[model samples]
Target: MPTYISAVFNKDTRTVEFTADNGDKLIRSGGSLAWLLNNPGNLRPGGKYAKMIGQADTKSGKFAIFPTAEDGRAEKRALLRRKYNDMTLYNAMHTYAPESENDTAAYLAYVRKRSGATDQTVIKDMTDEQFNGMIAAMEQYEGFNAKPETRKERIVHATQVTLSDGARPMPATPVIVRSSNTGEKKVTTNEHGALPTFITRQPGEVIELFLEESGKIGSRIGQFALQQASASLVFARNMMTVGGNSQPHTPTQPSKEKRTPLRYVVQPGDTLASIASRFKTSVDDLVSNNHIRNRNRIYPGHVVWIYGKAPADAANDGAPATPTRSRQASYSVRSGDTLSRIADRHHTSVDALMAANPSISNANRINPGQKITLPVGVEAVPPSAAGSSRRAGNSGNPQTSDRPSLVKPPPETPAAAVRPPASVQARDTRSREGEGHPIAIIPFSQKRAPWVEHAYAQARKWAGKKEAEISRTINFHSELGYGKQFTTLAGSSNAWCASFVNWCLRTAGYAISSPHPYRARSFAADTTRFSQIDEPVFGAVALVGTSHVGFVYAMDRGRPVLLGGNQSDQINFVRFNPATLRYYVPKSYLPFAQKELKETKLDELAATDLNAALGIVVAKKAGDNTR
Candidate 1:
């Protein structure tokens, strides 16, 4: 068994700290965490992080960082304790000792004298309780003039609030700030969607903020602590449209004219199809009810209207609906029972049977007396109805009959009895039916490379932003040491197609060796670092006729779908003719394995399987052929 570890994201430091069961700690930057959270599908089986978190099995206790309300409370408590200790020590030093080289010694002497201690005392040597008593005594000795009760001055903390949907700022949104110690008050956000700095006198002060707009409420509670100056809060609401205008509306009693439809808050990684599947509804119905113009663009915290009554397992408060398990029947394996034979008897496909039992690895192997689940309405074939060929003999050998045998046949008898001429044998071997038959195997190499995923993830973070926003982000990237090449490319008024790709690759841990990293043609001509390939794979850098460059993320009707920057001035997918594809640069880590399988027949393998192997999910649009 592997030890489970929990990771907590420290927004202040922009680092993620992992805690093990034994109290050991490991810290890493927030980039990887952001990638994982944004691209949960990339957490595939056998990946390095997936194994550590035990994602392969739901029963495994290990999980990636998904902070719950309880975890937040515990973190708050820890922050408060540290802040209190630091404040107490700071007051003791500043009040008793002057600013001098012997300040520590003088403070220790004053503490001992004030406490009336005969033994020598040091600040570090005293217990927390004793230190507090000494500080109180010293204050009293000075005629109690410092007002020890209010010795700690309140510090004003600033925070930004935004809508969970699209992470867009909620400027001018009315908010209510309440503190048990400081009292409740109303406030509003500035142009940046930031609340005015509120003062808190000490640590452990719980500050609750509620977003009040158009009579709707979105609340979050947290604590003020030392060394923690700013925070970003996401405000979520059950938004709906009323009188042809979008508004944040809470659940209310249905009027005589209408009944309130159940509300479903969209979560990250949610899609209209997925939400419809969960609620036993249709995507068309969801779009119709929500008046959604773009089905692919729903964001987290956006409240979608479900026109039907909530499922029995669905909570009224927009909790996810508990999935209903399908009915299944168990069957014991018999001698010589193959997965294909079992599926044939139960009227299920081998793939369906395998899906029903995830633990079953080899479809050809099954042990007698081992139990497996079968789809409901399937029954074992009666012995009388099961042909004699299907039965295994007492020796556990399958009987020979009309049914085909599972074992491979012995090699054909040596042709020595009638040996053919070398020329004839050579001609036969050269036939298309012989060794020339193409194998359509999808090798493990077809999966998207980690670097590609990293680059794609970075590109997605900038998707949907305007040119100015993208330019600002590019400038920030340069300041973070992305080099002058990026800064020079971004400073120009020219199209930034190549600069975007360069930025993504640099962020994904790839170094650009092109003499002119700003030009798409430069990447195409860089033969030393990049080798041109005929076929495109996910995450491959693609050049389009020396004018544009982007990452190939999908295929549609054999055309590469480019997910790159400057596509309509934003990161988006643009399908291009295969003929327009000029050069392809494969990631160094993921070299091609025999190029793509050359199967003449498209049905040899499903396109969905190919897409799954490549980790590509092409978004469908009106008149799109990929769908």
Candidate 2:
């Protein structure tokens, strides 16, 4: 049997970390909100299972709260056995994890592949092993495990625990856990007839456990105790001390090398690369030690553990090391250079490499001649220092220097250089500009319909605000109302992108007749309100495929600049190719805006005056790389 090792919850990222018996660390992030809620199948709480014992609503949101992983997985099996027993695997997946919110086809394919079963196989006809395997595959597809980027997976170890077979079965019984470190806490047994197991325990710690009477929490009737050691758990029936020693264990002998753990509180504008470099370590060490999800996002007060030897002075007093800036480096891509190879060559991470260079949209693909900026604290390798690789390029040329040169920061422009001329500001509608995707002030033409102008103004108001974390925005949720639908949007799904557009349209007095307005494709489906247009116009709704929606701000270089939320996880400018997008304008507004659209080369006309009307200064920068 596989042993359960460790579990950690990161509130900031809303992700959970767990370790398998083979020392493999599994990260539940992105589309794995069900994992964080302990719901393996993303099961709805409103179903018949909600009436079962110990069922409760989540305090954080509308997601169903399962007491344990075992219970959640068991509930998934129960759900499949009860309702989907007769349907084929493919047909069941369509109803269980619908395409309206989930990638149902991908879910079906993963289950079929993992279980070695066909899509036409019925759930009730499968063997026990195949059924369990199919359920495991479904959970894995739901984001229970993080996809490894490299060939060899990194490993970490944690203590393992197992309950003895002789222990009496207890269901819905609240277990009170009292420990020396953390105070007393009550954990109830799951309704799925599984006992709550404890995996995160320190060595040689004696924990007192009490069973509540009448299954009511905090009403202790009988007491039992368990002693926890590394990979060992000894349970006693009666109130008896398993370990002889009552006082905490202490070691009198001192080690030859003084290696004490050190912690550093993150300061503003600090990256994992900078912190690692300060301690003479690598970015991977900092990320693994701290369990950091997004290397680019570290808050001001977060405490990060520094591995290896501490500085002499700081180790004595145990004071946090002072913050200092690390020098940035830049590298020129070689013939066989990849982001992963470069990250391995230097003592940095692929995420750090991407953080330094924002323009790199894909890590797998990069041109040979592209200039790559190394993250802070990483030393860059020059062409000449690359040895044989460098000589091949400059074999005949003698003018190029062999010595490495430092990358210089961009020269700051004077205030006068950025300020628009007085004459331009007087007549230019885009005189004022804010940072990000629609890089200039939103050009709201009076010639458009009143609602179009209203929508433009509404989109402009939220042009710079960003989600604090994934799918988290106070004003957007407040306007849309946190309903059951938003709970299904997890992982890479853009939960609020459509809601942001809906809010903007609704706030501007434009009513959506569709019942499911939160879904992005709904805007394009409502033929009465929206009509597809070939020519992009100001304030037109642009639908990129089916997952995103944003308002067309201006035309720049044959591309339509869009102002939408969830673009790089912020309400900013995003440029989409004209061929890829389906542009739509309100039928009511098309009549009024046609005069502006009559220009044969509307994109060219907007490129010169509409897109260039505003002077821009970057006030803030968005960091997330997702849409």
Q: How many residue pairs of model 1 clash at the backbone? A: 0
- Candidate 1, residues 366-477: lDDT per residue as tens digits? 7999988763323343332232221221111110011110111112221112122111121111112223322221111112232344334434454344456656534422
TM-score of model number 2: 0.30
Q: Scored by Cα lDDT, where does model 2 land?
A: 0.47
TM-score of each: 0.26, 0.30
Quality of model 1 by C-alpha lDDT? 0.42
Clashes of each: 0, 6
> How much is 92 displaced in model 2, in angstroms?
14
- Report the C-alpha displacement of residue 531, candidate 2, in angstroms: 1.4
For model 1 the TM-score comes to 0.26
Q: Spell out the clash pairs found in candidate 1.
A: none
lDDT of each: 0.42, 0.47
